[model samples]
Target chain A: MIIQKPGIAGTLESSDAQVTVEPGDGKIEFELESAVINQYGLQIRKITYDTLKRLGIDNVKIKIVDKGALDCTLKARIEGAVYRSCNQYNDLPWGGAIQ
Target chain B: MKNPNMKRLRRTMMFLNAQKPGLIKDPYIYKPDSIMLDLEDAVAENQKDAARFSLYHALKEIDYHGVERVIRINGLDTPYWQEDIRCAVAGGCDAIRIPKTESALDIHLVEEKVLAAEKEFGRPEGSTLLMAAIESARGVMKALDICDASERLFGIALSGGDYTKDLQTHITGTGIELMGARQNLIIAARAAGKQCFDKVYTNLNDTEGFRKDVETIHLMGFDGKSIINPRQIRIVHEIFTPSQKDIAFSEKVVKEIDSKKAQGIGVFTVDGKMIDIAFYDGAKRTIELAKASGVYKGEL
Candidate 1:
């Protein structure tokens, strides 16, 4: 689904990641900041890219401020932001891709 | 993995705000019999849409070990409950807790949606369970009808926070304001063959007060309490543990019943307490609880 506008999910809490998705050009603009960036930064970026791709969106500016969140939390926050951008609140495919 | 049993031990169903990812991730570590992923009171109104996203994902990602996963959705009167069910059932939540349930129709409405979601999600039909929160005097008065409303219902819980507001009264030290409502709810749940839970004790500072309420409700035949904090879990479990005397007496009842069954005798006196087949289940359940609580010393 196409993202309608700027969408965000998660919180600036420990073990969570605050993700924001906004309109972008034909390129995927990704910015990430986390305490574990040096150790898990590449993994986090891959997960974000995979989650965004699974939601069928790529051309968006993604900002991730992670706080030691697990891969599952990252994926969930990313998907949530994607759906919020598209303004789809109902009928969430919970067991969907990036699970 | 136990298929969510209707008669599972639900001594404490702690309410965790679903929007809080940190709290929801590992609440099972405390070993509450159930964890209620709250989507109503704990969540802010503007963030209801956001909370569902987290709730659905947490329910999918977390294993939750053996602790029962319950989702306390918004009331049927609200616009959020149907969508809440869609997320909960798809995530395979063990039970859906309906808030401010006033009548049988409320449960029927949720049941209809739950069935549809189960079908749409390819879950086993009738796998999801439903519970109602009686939040007003009208709901208390209509308790039996509500309890008998749905076959998928495992029980009903009294939400004292809202009920007190509807009555224009407040909680008292001795629980006089809540005693009648609690009695009626337990009776209705028992009559309908469903488990009943006590309302949450809001005061965490008063350990003595909480203890009194727990003991009182246990005697009043409540299966559990909707708690907010983890500190209450140990206290509730300790209170629910079968004492040594209780275990011995229950063991004697079971042994005597087993031996007397050959003689076709259904009634007997165990330690001068009249016991029969009706008491058999209670006796066995005591032994099971004793074993589970690690207080049982007998070989049998």
Candidate 2:
């Protein structure tokens, strides 16, 4: 997904994938570009956003340029970026989102 | 450049305990001499940007209790490395652990990027330290030059797992194949008057084995071991501390050296070995360890 709305329930869309938000307690939207859309398009897109949701982050917008990243690499990069953006400083109450 | 005497380096236990979000909340509470809030391997790829943001916020928010803070950014070979360095330095990290450094040029390139980051962040020049993780054979070979390439270069580390993989060596706790690399890195770091650290022991269930490995590395002259589990911290601390007898002997050497100097003697014999200025250097190091470890609280 290239763009995601900033709210509890949002729409996610990508070149090869789309998911409807359940409007549940905790859900987030993350979107990114795949440098190698033919090789790692679906898996990279799914994992980048799935990780944030798993971490209980209710809302996010991710833009990934995947250069043939595998499942592991996709997960690593998304987690790295999310943590960095949220952890620019140590005083925020971003406790449950950061490890 | 902020504080020259701050070079009295502490043996740093950089913790890598980020499993769940709250799992690593109070990294400083663990009392690691350094905290490496990892954003590379421990994090997944798609989450790279988010993790970077999280790290930036964490560093800005968390009170790390004077513990030295570092960020293990992705390798320079990756697309994420530049942004990682930029955000890490801008967020006030003391050092950036450059991964997969295979040559002096790799370190030089990273140094340039870090210098730019420093300037961009308007940080004091030379406020950040560059720690190169030599994870390949080439990195080991060029370690000395890498260490000497920049004054901002604080130390080098031996990442055992990747090095073993790069060398196509079998993995085991024995670390037999890594012995040569470990020893060489220590020699290289010491030759450059810099610090060197051993890699993390991944076997969390094998605490005894981990302790033994820490002892081996400590005996081999490593400054410290990168610990993956908090359970392993005490083992590393124990291994790095000088024993009571060793501390006493070091104290005796210092006292004897003082008396001899007072009597106009330049040297003396300890246990039939020639004890000269060189011996005093070792004795002084032992005393410093004792002081740092809180074993020698008296005034020097």
Candidate 3:
């Protein structure tokens, strides 16, 4: 799905990641800010990219302010932000595209 | 299509915000009989959509270790309840709880949407059970209708916060304000053969008051109570579980009842008490509660 506008999901609370998705160029632009950056940075990046790919979002500026969120939480925040950006809330593909 | 879990033990149904990753990630550790993933009042107005995403993933990926997952959907008045149903059904939640249910029609509307979502998502036609939260005077008066609304409805719960507001009173912490509603709801649910749950006791600091409230509800014949904190779970379980002497007496009652029935006796005294068929189910229930609470190791 296309990122029609900027969308954000999640919180600065501990064990949550604030995900932001915005329209981008022809390629994916990724940025991350997390306290556990040195330890689990690569895994977090992989989860973000993998989730974006699954949602058919190839070109978007995705940023996550991670507070030690798990893989499932990161995916949820990404899905929430991506869906919100497209102004789509109903009839969401829960296990389909969002998985 | 009958729900086997209709009569399961639910001494405590803990509420957890669906939007909070930290809260929802691992609540099964506390081991409440069921976890209510609140997509309703617990979530902010603008965050409802985001909460659903969090809920769907949690339902799909989190292994709750057999703790029942009941999602509290947005009320019927909201535009969000439909999508909330779809997301919860598709994510394979065990049940959907409709908040502020006033009549049978409300349950029918929710059941219709749940059926459609189940079919659309390829779940079994009646796989998803439902619960109704009676939050107003209208809902309390119509409790019997709501209880008998659908075959998928396993129970009804009291949401005391809004209920008190509708009654033109506030929670007095003395349980005086909620007497009528609680009595009426339990009677309606029992009359309809559905389980009834009491409202949450919010004063966490007043453990003594909480225990008294729980004990009162338990004695008043409520099957369970809604809990806000894990600290409340142990207390509810402690009060709800049958004592060792009670369990032993129940076991003897069951055995005596069986033996007496085979010998063509209708009523008999057990331990100098006037025991009859009327006491049989109650005795059996005590034994069952013991077993469920992990305090019994008896064969019968």
The number of the candidate with the highest DockQ is: 3
Give the winner by lDDT. 3
> Judged by DockQ relative to the true structure, which candidate is superior, 1 or 2?
1
Model 3 ranges with Cα > 4 A deviation: none
After superposing all C-alphas onto the true structure, candidate 3 shows an RMSD in angstroms of: 1.1
Question: Please, what is the TM-score per model?
Answer: 0.94, 0.74, 0.98
How well is each residue in A9-89 modelled by candidate 3, as lDDT tens digits?
Answer: 999999999999999998899999999999999999999889988988899999999998988899999999998999998
How do the residues A1-99 of candidate 2 rate in per-residue lDDT, one tens digit apiece?
A: 111332211112221212222222344544555556776677665665566665565555445654443343344345444434444323222223432
How would you encode candidate 1's per-residue C-alpha lDDT over B76-160 as one tens digit per residue? 7788999999889988899999999999999999999999999988999888998999999999999999999998999999999
Angstrom error of the Cα, residue B253, model 2: value is: 1.4
- Ordered by DockQ, highest first, the candidates read 3, 1, 2
Q: A5-43 in candidate 1: lDDT tens per residue?
A: 999988999988999999888779999999889999999
How far is each candidate from the true structure, as Cα RMSD in Å? 2.3, 10.6, 1.1
Model 2, runs deviating above 4 Å:
A1-99, B2-12, B15-20, B266-274
TM-score of 3: 0.98
- What lDDT score is found at residue B9 in candidate 3? 89
Q: What share of the true interface contacts does candidate 3 keep?
A: 0.83
> What DockQ number belongs to candidate 1?
0.62
Clashing pairs in 3: none
